[model samples]
Target: MRAVACVLFILSLVWDSVRADNSISSLKMAAASWEGELPCKEWNCECAFKQRGCCCAATDLQEVEDQIFHKVMDLSRRVFQLGDTILEVLGGIRVAFTASMSHKKTCFGPFTRSTPIPYNLLTFNHGSGYNPALGIFTAPRPGLYSFSFSVYSKVQGEGEKMYYKVQLMRNGEAVVSTWEDNREDSEDSSSQTVLLSLEQGGQVYVQLLSGRQLCGNIEGLNTFSGALIYPTLT
Candidate 1:
C-alpha cells in the first residue's frame, strides 16, 4: 500500500507540471494529492498500513487511502504506457484544453435557435482538438472526457435580459447547461461541467440560445474547457 502511495507521489509530480495543459494532467495532480501518505519509499517494499505491518486494512482509515492510491495507479497506467515516465507519457499521451471568447469580443448571440458559440481565445489547447474558428471540440481519441463552460452577459439595455442560457453539448446532444438571468445585476454569469464517455472523433461544443447573449472583455469572462479523464483503450 505504501508502495502505491509512493508511486502516486511520483506521478503527482508530472500531474503538477502539466495541469494547465490538459484534463489528464489536471487529474494527475488530483492523483498525486489524494489523501494517502506512502508508508514506504520503495515500491514492493513491505508497508505498515498503520504500525509496522500491523496497520492492517481491517483496522484503518489510511487503508481507504491505500485503496484509492491503487486505483490511481491503475488509472495512471491506463493513461501512460508501461515503463514510460509520467512526463514522457504526457507528451501526446494526454489531451486537454481551456479556451475563451476573445477579449475583444462582446457577445455570442441573439439568434433564433441555439448556435455553436466560438471561443476564439485559447489559453491552452494541449490536444489541438478545439477550433477557434468553428467553436467546436472534436475529440482526438476515445476516452472519458471532462468538459466545462461558463456564460456571462452584460445588461446592455433596459430590455436586454441580464441572463442567458448556454448549453454544453456532446455530439449535438445537450449534456448540461449554464443559465444566468439576474435582472438586479448589470452582469450575470453561470457555468456547467460534465464528464462524458466519448469515442474517437466525437465532438463537444457550446451553444448559445437564440436572442440570448454571452459577453466578455479582454479579461475573458466566458470560457470553455475539457480534458481526457481516462483513456478507455488498454
Candidate 2:
C-alpha cells in the first residue's frame, strides 16, 4: 500500500507537462476492479511502476480534473467573445436607407423643352442619403438598390392636356421613365420603380424632362425613395 501511494505521486508530476490541450490521459495502472484510475498509458505501466509511480488518488486527481474544466470553460468564453465582436462589426456595414420628398405644392414649369425637376421638399430622409437641396442620393456603399418615384400634375381646365414626365437618372444617364398625358382627365399622374446595382459614390435622382411641367399638391404624393437590397461593402 505504501509503494502504491509513492508510485501514484510520481505520475501526478508528469500530468502537468503531458496534458496541455485538455484531453484526459488513459490510465496505465488500471485495476481489474472499480477502485481507482491511473493517468499513464497502458503500455508503459511496468516502466512507470519501476521508475516513477502508479497514479494519483481520487481526491488529488479530482483537483486536476476541476482545473482542466475551468481552463476549458475559460477558452470557450474567449471564443464566444471573439465571435460576438465579429458579428457587431459585420452588422455596422449592412447598407440600408429609405427617403422621400414632401407632397406639398412644388412646380417646375413652362420650359420649351425637357428639364430636370428638382424635388426640393424632403419629407423623410432615412440614413440622410437623400439630399433635398441637390435632389440626389449618393450611394454610400456598393449594392443592389431599389428606387421609386411618383409624379403628379394638373392643368387649369378640364379639356387641357397635362404633360407630366420624369425619368430616373443615374449619374446623368436616364434609366427608367414615367409619363402622363390626359385624354378625358385634366390631371395626370404616373409612377415608376427601378432596381439598379450601384457602386459606392454613384448618384441617383429623379429628373423632370425639359419642356414638361409638373406639380404635386400639399399632400406631398410626389416622392422618391430608395433602399439597399444586397450589400456589396464589407
Candidate 3:
C-alpha cells in the first residue's frame, strides 16, 4: 500500500510540471502570433509575459495607450499656437504705394514744358527756396521692403533735365534719403533706389533740391507713377 501511494504522488507531480510548461508555451505562441496591436512583436518578452499574465498585462497596456494619446494632443496644441503667432505677425504689415506725380501738368510722362506745375515742387524754407521738401508716402506694411523713385526736369534753354531725391520715413522720422544732382539738361530721366526697414503705418516721401541757379520740379505730363515693393506672407 505504501509503494502504491508513492507512485501516485510521482505521477501527480509530473502532470503539474507538464501543465505549467504547456501554459508558458501557449503564451509565447500567442505573443508571436500577434503583430498589429503593440509597439513590439515576435521578440518582445514583455508581450509574452503579458499574454501569460492576463488582467495585469491588459491594465499596463491601457495605461501606455492613455499616455501616448495625451502626448499627441499636447503636440497638436503646440502646433496650433505657433500658427496663430505667425498669423498675428503677418497681419501687422501696412505698407503701400500712395501718390505719384510729375511736372508735365497733364500726368502723362515725367517730362513736359507746361507752367503752373501739376505736382507740388518740394521747397526749403531757405532764402533761395533752393531745397525742396520731400513728398509724403504711407507705409502699407510693417516690415523690410524696397522702393524706388524717378524724376525728370526740363531745362529752360536746352531740353529735358532729370534730378531725383528719395527718402524713407518712419513715424514722421527720416530713416533714409538719397539725392542725385546731375545738371545735364540733355538727360531726359534720373532715378534713385532705396531699401528700407519700416514699421506698419509708416510714411515716406520724395524731395527735389535745387542746385546753383537752376530750379527744378518733378515732371508730370500725361502720367506719373510711383511704386512700393514688398514680399507677401507665404
Task: Summing lDDT over every window of 10 consecutive residues in candidate 2, give the lowest-scoring window.
Answer: 25-34
1-234 per-residue lDDT for model 3 (tens digits) = 332333233334344445656565554454445444432222344442455433223555678899999999999999999999998765443333323453443322233321211234432211121112244444454455565555454454563444434334445455555444555644345455667665545555543323311234444321112333454443
Ranking by lDDT: 1, 2, 3
RMSD (Å) per prediction: 25.8, 11.3, 13.9
lDDT of 1 by residue, 182-210 (tens): 66777776678889999999999998878
lDDT of 3 at 211: 32
lDDT of 2 at 194: 88
Candidate 3: give its CA RMSD in angstroms.
13.9
lDDT string for model 2 (1-234, tens) is 444654555446455444654333333323222234443333244554445543334345678799999999999999999999998866655554444445544456757765555557655554567677778888877888998888777676657767767889998899999887765767776788889989888999887777777654614566777887877754
TM-score, candidate number 3: 0.39
* TM-score, one value per model: 0.59, 0.59, 0.39
Q: Which ten residues in a row have the lowest lDDT in candidate 1?
A: 41-50
